[model samples]
Target: MPAGPVRTRDEVVTALRDSAGVGMGYVPLGAAFGILLVTSGLEWWWAPIFSVVIYAGSMEFLAISLVTGGVGLAQVAATTFFVNFRHVFYGLSFPLLKVRSPIGRLYGVHALTDEAYALLATRPHAQLTGPQVLATQILCHLYWLTGSTLGALLGAGVGLDVEGLGFALTALFVVLTIDAYRSAPDVGTLVLALGCAALALAFVPGGMLVAALTAFLFVLLGRYTLRRRRVA
Candidate 1:
């Protein structure tokens, strides 16, 4: 069989729109993040710098407070690990390992924001050629970079409307959570969420992200125990 056409302008454009479709909310959120970074003590240009280089959404936000506080490197490293070690799970959840090259693999890994991961994974696997995957990741990256840079450059003009933009990510996550619960039949998951929420309310420092991860871990452990019981 002839190899599928190398990603052309048309495919790239489609990927851009597809990627950017998911990024629509991200743009405003990223811009708001930029504003927060600027307000918190980061130099204006650092907004774009971190967004482009770190490419980790929540990490950038955390770093803002950390920087202002003069947090030590070890503390920052520890924080990044606890907060984003979940990316480690992405390797298991990833469905696109088969088609990509080493370079594409690296790029995809770097681009794995929560929004991008969901958008990319839920896509039909066959639909994404390497070029398409690269295109999608690039679009998402550029969206963050552009949004951050714009907000940083124009921080003086930012107004209250930005708070609504920041809520877009929360709203998007809410929709995803509702969808998960709607179709889920697992009793363990519901229990785990409640348990984690309780633990999170009591202990976790980073807030919602940590709480959600804790909840997910509870569900995983519960499911594993149930499976073992069935097997034994």
Candidate 2:
């Protein structure tokens, strides 16, 4: 028999207790998102709407520019797919957990943020349970929705501190970069990622992602070529 499922509390305090430290992280990130949304010309209501409807923070940011620049849906969708391609990998690790319902799977996709993944990934594999996962996802979405709306609402009153708030997204990217580099045991891969970042900084204008992906492929090819030569 499967080790039975865990239960989620039906209220806020329980959700907070379950979420632990992740809530603190979500607050500021959510605030920054709200500010970004308001500054980008989205109506205050749209802040919460997108936060709920799209729910992909980075993609939401990208969407703002896409909307303002008059980019079509096709281009916007392509960028979003490229940017979030890594989420596909998240599915691999937690693919067959205890999610037993269609709605749970639906919520699962909606709640698949970087923070949520990190939190759940730490659990002992078999020890993980359905309700706990749902709780984490629900709480995260709520926090994001609330924080984002608050920021946008506040923006209408007093406006955003542009310089300071812009750093929020930059900080997120830096943290992600550090985490990714730390994952590869080989220093060479780290160096390659950094070099690619620098090259993007130099040559790619609004094309940083394209550069990064290219660099990743280039590094892989170089590694393969070296191995093939040695074998030959």
State which candidate has the highest lDDT.
1
Alpha-carbon deviation at 164 in model 1, angstroms: 4.8
Ten residues in sequence with the least summed lDDT for candidate 2 = 2-11
What does candidate 2's lDDT look like per residue over 141-210, in tens digits?
8877887888888877788764565455456555544554455356887678778878887888577766
- Global CA lDDT of candidate 2, please? 0.72
Superposed Cα RMSD, model 1: 4.0
TM-score per prediction, in order, is 0.74, 0.69
Model 1, position 77: C-alpha lDDT score: 91
Q: Model 1 scores what on Cα lDDT?
A: 0.73
Tens-digit lDDT string for candidate 1 (1-232): 3345533676788887766555776678788888887777567889888987788877887888898999999999999987788787665666557435888788788887776666566556666666776777788888888888777767745532355666677786666555546654556666776777777777874585566675676678788899999999
Q: Rate the local accuracy (lDDT) of all candidates.
A: 0.73, 0.72
- Per-candidate clash tally: 0, 0
User: lDDT at 83 for candidate 1?
Assistant: 73
